[model samples]
Target: MKVVVAGSSGLIGTALVAALRRDGHEVTRLVRRPANARDEFRWDPARADLDERALRGADAVVNLCGAGIGRRRWNGSYKQELRDSRIVPTDVLASAAAAAGVRTLVNASGVHYYGGDSGDRIVTETSPAGTGFLAGLCRDWEAAAQPAADAGVRTILLRSAVVLARHGGMLGMLYPLYFLGLGGRLGSGRQYVPWISLDDEVGAILFALTDDALSGPVNMVGPAPVTNAEFTRALGRALHRPTPLMVPAFALRVTVGEFADEGILHGPRAIPTALEDAGYSFRHPTIGAALAATVGRS
Candidate 1:
């Protein structure tokens, strides 16, 4: 199948593109800069300008455009930026997919759709959208794909969890601290941390593209859910270091502001009800195995 991908330079996009190509699918990357490569095309979501010519003949459109949520403090402007960053690109693609007659739209979303404070309640794809800034963000983010859905396109919203990889995502930013033996639980360390390895993340995306039964929201997370303390311990074990520290809630707020409360500390136990029902197996089902796979990689 021919796939048109936005945000091809991102962490998941990079791996997805390679995996798609390895499996003999034709992958075209949507870029913002002037297009020069045969596999690259230019599109600007801010202006809502897309080269529809490049979108033609595509079997599916995968939209992954978004700014880093935790890369900066959530000021009013940055919060608005986060909303715009996702909505604009997704809206653009959804509208374009319908116009281009694309069959599928596997759009990106987050586990925070269940809110940052879901605590220990087991969340599934059928679960209603929760509250808070991220839940609102995710709600609107997935709604942007309504254009294609209304146009009769098969649409799937991937509510992804904390992706674990060696070079990017949360691990890239937090691993250094863990490696230096400064890593431990946050606050009470009881909040759940839903996670998935990069490999499984890519694999799940591929599965969604071909699976006709999948629609609406699918939790792109692993089967095993662990507490913050368990995650901290797993990382320390993976690195062969001792974790004898804890970053308190107040300290996190002082460091990353409200992200500490909702983004960092609160945990939602999202299960892959949709994926599992769809009959897709997880490559890394446990946090310890995920950490080992991620850290063991070259």
Candidate 2:
């Protein structure tokens, strides 16, 4: 299969590109900078500028474009950046894919589409969009891909969980702290943490690219559900460290502002119902296994 990937420098994007190439799929990467390699194409999503050649004869176009939501304190400007960063690139790629008649469009989304603090409710692909800024951002982000689906291309919206990896992402920020014995639960440690391993995250994207019956929103999370406290303990156990500290909600709010509330204090109990139904097997099915695999390498 011929696959074109956008946001190829990101954590998930890098892994996905490598996995696609390893399997002998011809991969073309869309870069914001000048094209530097044979498999690279330059694109500007802010202006929705992309050469149709990027998508020509492509079996699938996987878009993973977005600014890091937790990369900065949420001011009005940063929030807008979050929305534009995702929506603009997605719109560009989707429109280009439609124009080139690409067979599949696998777009990135977040489990936060179900909103923060879903409590104990199980979130599935059919679950209605939830409330809050991130939810709205995700809604708009996925909606940007409508052109592709409308053009008869199979569109897959990956409502992905907090991806766990050895080097970057949530674990990256926490690894050093935990290694220094500063790791602990945030807030009351009761909020569900929807999460997935980097390996499975990449695997799921590859699965979505070829699985004809899979389209629409798919929750790319683990089969098992875990609360913040459970995750804290598991991570602590994995690192052979004691998680004895607790970060209060007030402290978190003072530290990271709105993100402290939505990104850390609350999360959905999202499950991979669609992926499981499609016969996708997870390499790290449990949080313990996931942390072990990630932290063992760190």
TM for every model, in the order presented, reads 0.98, 0.98
Q: Find the 10 residues in a row with the least total lDDT in model 2.
A: 289-298
* Residue clash pairs of candidate 1: none
Clashing pairs in 2: none
- Candidate 1, residue 58: lDDT: 96
- Put down candidate 2 lDDT per residue, 1-298, tens digits, no spaces: 9999999899999999999999999999999999999999999888888877778899899999999989988999989889999999998888888888889999999999999857889989988888899999999999999989999989999999999987899999999999999999999999999999999999999888888999999999999989999999999999999999999999999988888878899898988999999999999999999999999634
- Badly placed stretches (over 4 Å) of model 1 are none
What is the Å distance of residue 37 in model 2 from its true position? 1.0
**Candidate 1's TM-score:** 0.98
